[model samples]
Target: MSRTSTESVTPTPAVARRHRLPGKALLGLFLAGFVSILTECLPAGLLPEMSRTLDTSVSLTGQTVTLYALATALGAIPLARATNKMPRKHVLQLALGVVAVTNTLTALSDDYLLTLVIRFVAGLGTGLIWPLLGGYAARLAPAGRQGRAIAIALAGTPIGLALGIPVGTWLSGLGGWQLAFHASAVATIATMAWAMATLPNLPGRPAEARFTISQALVIPGLRTILFALAAYMVAHNILYTYITDFLSHAGMAGQTGWVLFAFGVTSVLSVLVVGTHIDRHLRKLAVGSTAVFAASVLVLALFTNAPVLVYVAVAAWGFAFGSSPSLFIGAAINATGDAADVAQSVTITVFSASIAVGGLTGGLLISGLGTASITWAALALLIAAAATVIGGRKHAFPRNS
Candidate 1:
């Protein structure tokens, strides 16, 4: 594993001795996360409009998102490896640049194939960004606030997941699909500039200090973290991927945006709570999040006809899920120590793969079984994830750090 630089150069010993959060730098990372998700999910929200503009079927237009996820999944580790020795800030800059350029091209692309290619490149850029964000935030933080810093940096995820699509959809309605994408491009560009101005420059590690990806995988608890991550993500995506359909099935299709907004709001609150206590209660929080998630899915499975319960379940689900990146990435860094970067990369790869798994599995279940079946499947996976977390208590999610 390699050490990742956050915004700037490594802090001096005197700076490292302080006990304060670098708010601007962490928020820069937050914006990076925001743009990453906003870019990936914007297309899904505007699929019908984008399909019409590109003169393709809705299914084909949807492939833009599919290809993006695949690219991120396939490219994460390799990209992490390729850029391991580069200055952390430069790597971040390069990634932001790629995303900015690709997003602009995606907005301008009239051909579906070209849009797919542009999105794939955008995915690769995100692949590089996701793997380093937590570790980067950790390095940027002073002692005792690493978890808080991670929470702040990763908060962009749930916010983007919550607002990005709805906003993009709104933008598409007002202007067109291209306007939504152009907004993404502009956001990425602005975030890149903020990162450059706020983040310090840290030199890359020497080759001798880096460990192989194989070595990272063999670390004591890395595999367990990755497994739990995969399972949790799969469980989340199953219901999430077809949320609109599930709402439609529940006769609340018109409330899709509001439901997601509720989910997002709770998720942000979850981040705040998790950030405040994560360093002291990592294991307890991780286990509780999984359990709550499972419980929420159970409610969804049994009470689809109850609109009030549905909203409550979705809100609970979001709160349970909101701090996951902070929890999992924080755990991985704790487990692998110096190999945190590699482990983060591996964790991200699994996370992306799980998205594909969840989507495919959800589609299969919905087509053959019904939207109701997806909730049960999500419950089963959540149970597995919870089991792994409890069972790996000694190393993976140790009670004491």
Candidate 2:
């Protein structure tokens, strides 16, 4: 499990030069990343309204988030395998195209079941997008700048969550949930066009070794990081999936958009800070951020009445969670070397699965234990995630090459 045991795989000079298109390509990837997350999380902010419109319980509307995550979890590996031979740029375009079309259909659909099915389709595209984009970012980066490059690309998640989710929520308030989806469709289409114009043609390399789930499971570093990631994400989604509801319950209903906006703003700031240091301090960054995130959730759980405290907690949570994917993905790539794609795919699967479980469990908890219980539930999971990192400190993060 030591870093020394895993050999670092270097890219050929010719391949590196071919894939390197840092400026515009990185920006395009960032927007694509933002759109991907915005599409997945759009339902979170509009759950109550969507439930009323579809004549269903809020808990049932929440299942749409679960469904999308489950679909992405199930499809990530198979879809990655299927497209392993295609050019990376084409795969990205195709995935974004699916996002655009499915979201458009989502906006147009009036039936709950039809919307769920279309979201599931969008999930399939999202499944392909995450790992491919991560790998693509890694490929495009110039040597030591891989961590920052991936951070820039993956910054979309928080940016989307920070800006897109709140904006979507506000738009839904003005024009209904359908308007939110329509906007997502428009944004995704624009991202696709930018990607097409900017991204270099990145053909896949043939596998150097037979990469499989069983192999990934046996790698000690990979196993520990994935487990830690699952726990962290489960904690994150539990609170995230129901934040609007929690806000409403706290009598802060009118402030949901503004609160989420504040959260996103700090998130972007945190990613920028973490991006610079992740290559040198992967394990410390992982452990420290999760600890901050967990502490923030505890504050929310315990100090619900103080508005100032609540906003502080939200900003802390945003800053901590915002920097996580890049930290985790960078750790995974360091762990798996030549099998980075397999590692990335497995990480995405674990991530999506955790989101599915967390959202579903949060729904059940909300129905039975009430909305406030979710933060406590999330804090417990985050504690476990932190322990995983501390316990596997030596093995989970290898030395930067």
TM-score, cand. 1 vs. native = 0.95
lDDT of 1 by residue, 1-401 (tens): 12223557777878765757988999999999989988888987898999988999987887787788889999999999899889889999999899999988998989988888888999999999998788888889877778889889988887887776688889999999889888888989999999999998777767788888899999888899888988999999889878989999999999999999999999999999998988778888899999999999999999999999999999999999999988888899889988888888888898888877887889899999988999999999999999999888888998674
Which runs in model 2 stand beyond 4 Å of their true positions? 1-21, 52-55, 207-210, 399-401
For the record, the alpha-carbon RMSD of candidate 2 to the native fold, in angstroms, is 4.4
Best model per TM-score: 1
Best by lDDT: 1
Candidate 2 worst ten-residue window by lDDT? 1-10
- Cα lDDT tens digits, model 2, 59-128, are 7887777788888899999999888888999999999999999998988876889889998999999999
Model 2, residue 231: what's the lDDT?
Answer: 92
lDDT of each: 0.88, 0.84
| Total backbone collisions for each predicted model | 8, 1
